[model samples]
Target: MLSGNTKFLQGVQIYLLSRDHSNLKSDFRHGNGKIMVNCIENQPAAELVLGKHVFLSVAEYYLRTKTG
Candidate 1:
């Protein structure tokens, strides 16, 4: 039942979260952190698009949990 904008935002959040934590290495942090940091550093446009999506997903989750 999400609106178009809401859906787009959810998608973007999913994408960003995936990129941020997709690769897990050791407990001390190594390659995964670097990969996410590099992505944020190199791709500004993508980050902007990603930032929009994060909030909406949280909102949607809140709504669903509240009602259920």
Candidate 2:
């Protein structure tokens, strides 16, 4: 997460407000659980896994902090 003073982490709900999903995913994947992803979008990133009709981008599963 490249925010001012916020640290992003897995399992943490963030409001992604970017149109650059590819860049975000790439940044998140570059680190080995070191990068935090934060979203300021109208939708919550976690909701993709919590709600119906959710669509996950490529490599999203690997970025998830939790696995069930």
Candidate 3:
């Protein structure tokens, strides 16, 4: 069983791996925050298993720490 943070990071890596550079840049500039939050929020089982506010906390941290 993966930890919530590990799952989230893996999800992000998998998601990024499926996109092209241009699309990734567009997502970053546009609706990436909402998209990421939605992705995490949609995983109900993961949320329940992790036993924390995984989506919001991860999203907030990602936003605050991510850089070019």
Cα RMSD of all models vs. native, in order, equals 9.5, 10.4, 9.1
lDDT (CA) per prediction: 0.38, 0.37, 0.45
Q: lDDT (0-100) at residue 54 of candidate 3?
A: 25
For candidate 1, the lDDT comes to 0.38
Candidate 2 lDDT, 1-68, residue by residue in tens? 22343333222423333336665445444643234333444423332321111224434444453453
**What TM-score, to 2 decimals, does candidate 2 have?**
0.30
Instruction: Kindly report which residue stretches of model 2 are placed more than 4 angstroms away from their true locations once superposed.
Output: 1-15, 37-67
Q: Quick one: ranking by TM-score, best first?
A: 3, 2, 1
- The candidate that wins on TM-score is 3
Write model 1 residue lDDT over 2-66, tens digit each, in one string.
24555454554555566533232231145322223223323333323122223225665577568
Q: What TM-score does candidate 1 reach?
A: 0.28
* TM-scores for every candidate against the unseen true structure: 0.28, 0.30, 0.39
State residue 51's C-alpha deviation in candidate 2, in Å: 14
Pairs that collide, model 1: none
Winner on TM-score (2 vs 3): 3
Q: How many clashing residue pairs are found in candidate 1?
A: 0
lDDT of 3 by residue, 1-68 (tens): 23556666677556556667566545545753323423544443321211122223455557656741
